[model samples]
Target: MKLENMVRKVYPNLMPYVCQLADLPIEEMKQALGKEQVYKLSFNENPLGPSPKAVKAMQEALLQLNLYPSSTGDALLARIGDKEGVEAKNVILSNGADEMIILVAQTFLEPEDEVIIPEVSFVQYLASTHMMGAKPVFSPMKEDLGVDLDAIIERITPATKTVFLCNPNNPTGTVIPADELRAFLKRVPENVLVVIDEAYHEYADDPEYLSSVEFVKTYKNVFVIRTFSKIYSLAAARIGYGIGQEELIEAIHHVRPPFNVNSIAQAGALASLDDEQHVSESRRINQFGRKLLAELFDELGMKYLKSATNFVCVDTGRDSGYMFDQLAKHGVIVRNLAGYGMTTSLRVSIGQPEEMQAFAAAMREILEKEEK
Candidate 1:
């Protein structure tokens, strides 16, 4: 009897994550192209880098490398609770927002249950649902590229266990209006969980946009998932948190592993919270970069979606894969949306001022050559 033949029949072989072309390692691309300078604008990472306070804290935390991290991550939870106006008991921190997504699936989903997500949104929602053998229902976005709350609401059935909404949605960078969200929440069944993934929360300053944390207080089934990876520039630290009712959070805790969030991440996240100046500066850079990119696109006569997040999705009027390769040769990297079914579109992250300028110059050269 072969060991491979003895595997569980119901378990499906999972496919490896297929990343966007722009997300491939810059160093590898640089080596291939023989280019020295690489501008990474594919991951929506903070251009200014990590908070100074966070860097200092992580460096000092090296002294405790021999010791185990705090299992509860209580101090960081307290800071998050204070900032989000939620009780520490109602918050669950994870290695990253990605971990939180898996935790929710492990806690709430069962075989045959339905999980709703936007068609062009985060890939994790589908991956988590598949991991649990749950059915994933993709609701298509509206004409303007925003989440169609009405479509999502109409698709909900008793089998629907979770609905993941990415505010200032990824790839597209469009947001669901506060009024629309409030209306949608009211229509959601109490048993169905509503997950609001606000990974780019710090970048969104639109007057009509509402933070989902406020709903965690009023609704038992709502969870607001946030991360330090964005504005805090703590992507490498892998720290994020989810806010929900105390009972909901307790259920997730039951499935959480001990010391799931490391001490260094906890230290970095806590210190980053206190660094308001850094947060403000990151926001300023993102806002300026977004504006600059938009203007560049306008000058080039390229069509682009107005962005509320650090990235903008633009129609390049050519095959994105070819364009991605072209940009890589020029030492400029950006996200190719071919995997998202937008073959002619590319998602570009706002970088430092000089890097954005470089991207603009590279893009102009690429487009001009295509014309000739």
Candidate 2:
């Protein structure tokens, strides 16, 4: 039998995206532990839970589960446009921003085309580029773990088609400043698409952090991908979007599957968008939790990166595996960065105030017990 007919074959090119490293595996852990009282701080979800407005929206949307989602989602697109000062014609919603990244790659990349991303940023950019049979180039982070703009500029070449800069990057919680990003964008080849994945934009209160929404309007090569997951507490709902020149968005839409986002996500995201009180409360809680975690790290003499996002990258100064296990025994889960190649580090999503307090107590016990 021919190789194509002898047996079923996997898409060799698309396996990377298909085999996503489960960003958080605590759900499986929850199963193993028989549903004990656990504090789930592993996935960096908003401990505040979904917005009150969004909960109401989902409850209302339950009546329509029998019907297919409005794939066009023109109304949500319009709401996004009104908020971002863009035309609805320029926006495209997807299952989540990860899907938007995939859409861009599928629509634009060709075999051997080069995609560039930060050395220690979101892993999805690498997966998206690889899925298209493309080469992914990395711009190494500086000593402080922020994107090294100079390294990025050095890597630009004729084959490059896409460049993703994840502002306030994951696994490190570092961001490229406004002036640096502006200057870098000026030098980037206009022929290549530049994507700023601002999934954590809502948590970024730094005055110097620039939202690329305005840049997308000014530069045809620019695209801004944002998600409802982070601050809106809608990760389970999976609503995200991309904004860019109308022509680029139209092209991306060609590869998007019909009805990719379900009815519940659309309705919940729309309601969450208008819940300013919930958003404010979330920000306040995140700020408080972040500070408390920092203090605990200081008291323990453990070093950590000060974050502008909801999670913190703590240098555990020893193998992270033991502490990770110990914390699980304490029922307070966190992200193990060893998979991200930070063998001595762990990433903890700031949870509710009491969860934070309990986590601090657990940390003391683990460290003390380990030392003993």
Candidate 3:
């Protein structure tokens, strides 16, 4: 008669996705630190904020809040199709890229199926796989913390249903080269699905980096996921989408919830497409901030990954938990990697120049105090 017995068998064994360390609200953190200003660089948000056009569109769309939005985000799909050079039929909209990950698992994963996941990539991929009662096969990353495409290909078995690839992967911020990924795709069995999570796609400027959207055009099994949360500064709106072959998208529609994306989010995302200037400026500032952070890490004699995304992962040569607490006390909040089994590393998001300078000063002060 216990409610716990009614829950799915997989629910008890699954681990929650932990993306942040500090539990306190910003106001509470400020009060505790006794600081006038706190720089939250824990989340990889667009430092420039949301686009003006998107904000204006969301404001105008507010008048129609009483009505439900397009059940499938038809207009936004059309615009995304135009941008990605795919037909409207090739895309599926979701509450966020996170939900799309879940929907894909719901549609394709059988209880016994196995999903190949990079060892240190986004935690949601593992969470989603477990939700469907699927076996998750962890593929170890290379020594440099880059996705090991070759190793993943070798791990494929007949039971493998899907392979999750996070391009310019979260935390590590490393990307698999286009040639290597193409080669990997060719070797993968057409029957197995490849879910490419490209949440940080716009931030990657490396010439070798190729969006999996190109693969989606030719490979019926390749599904590319993207979001407005990262570059469009619409993290709060929670709008994300997936691109794949028309048939693949059609299959996923069976599990999609009605009116999943709200009206204001749709309007903002639609208008964000036209705001090329804002996108460009955001990318520019990210590039500048990344370079500055890399230089600072170099000067500090810390080992850090060469990032292709908006955040950089650096080894602190001390307990990451301690580093996180000290930095938080100094009004600089960064991501602690303890949840990911990385005890001596932290992931710092790219912020504005002034914010980055604040982080730099905080680091120097902390290291000096430790030396003393």
Candidate 3, residue 348: lDDT: 95
Question: Residue-wise lDDT of candidate 2 within 1-372, one digit each (tens)?
Answer: 676676333245444323222243556656655556567777789988898889998999999899998887999999999999999999999998889988999999987799988878887888788778788898888988878988988999999999988887887887788999889889988999998899999999877788989798789999999999999999988989999999999998899999998989999999999999999999999999999999999999999997889999999887887778778788777877887677889899989999998899999998888778
Candidate 1's displacement at residue 133, Å, is: 0.4
- lDDT for each residue of candidate 3 in 1-372, tens digit (9 for 90 to 100): 796788898988687644343545567767777888989888898999999999999999999999989898889899999999999999989998999999999999989999999999998898899999999999999988899999999899999999999998998999899999999999999999999999999999888899999999999999999999999999989999999999899999999998899999999999999999999999999999999998999999999998889999999899999999889888899889887788999999999999999999999999999889
Tell how far residue 152 is off in model 2, in angstroms: 0.8
Clashes of each: 0, 0, 0
RMSD of each predicted structure: 1.5, 2.5, 1.5
Give the per-residue lDDT digits (tens) of candidate 1, residues 1-372: 986688643356456666443556768767766878899899999989998899999999989999999987999888889988889998889999999999999999998799999999988988888888889999988987889999999899989999999998998998889999999999999999999999998899888799999998999999999999999999988999999999999999999998899999999999999999998999899899999999998998889997889999999888999988888888888888998889999999999999999999999999889789
TM-score of each: 0.96, 0.93, 0.97
Sort order, TM-score high to low: 3, 1, 2
- Once fitted onto the true fold, the runs of candidate 1 whose alpha carbons sit more than 4 angstroms away are 1-13, 18-21
Q: How close is candidate 2 to the true structure, as a TM-score?
A: 0.93
lDDT of each: 0.90, 0.86, 0.92
Worst 10 residues of 1 by lDDT: 7-16
Which is superior by TM-score, 1 or 2? Answer: 1
Residue 351 of model 2, lDDT score: 91
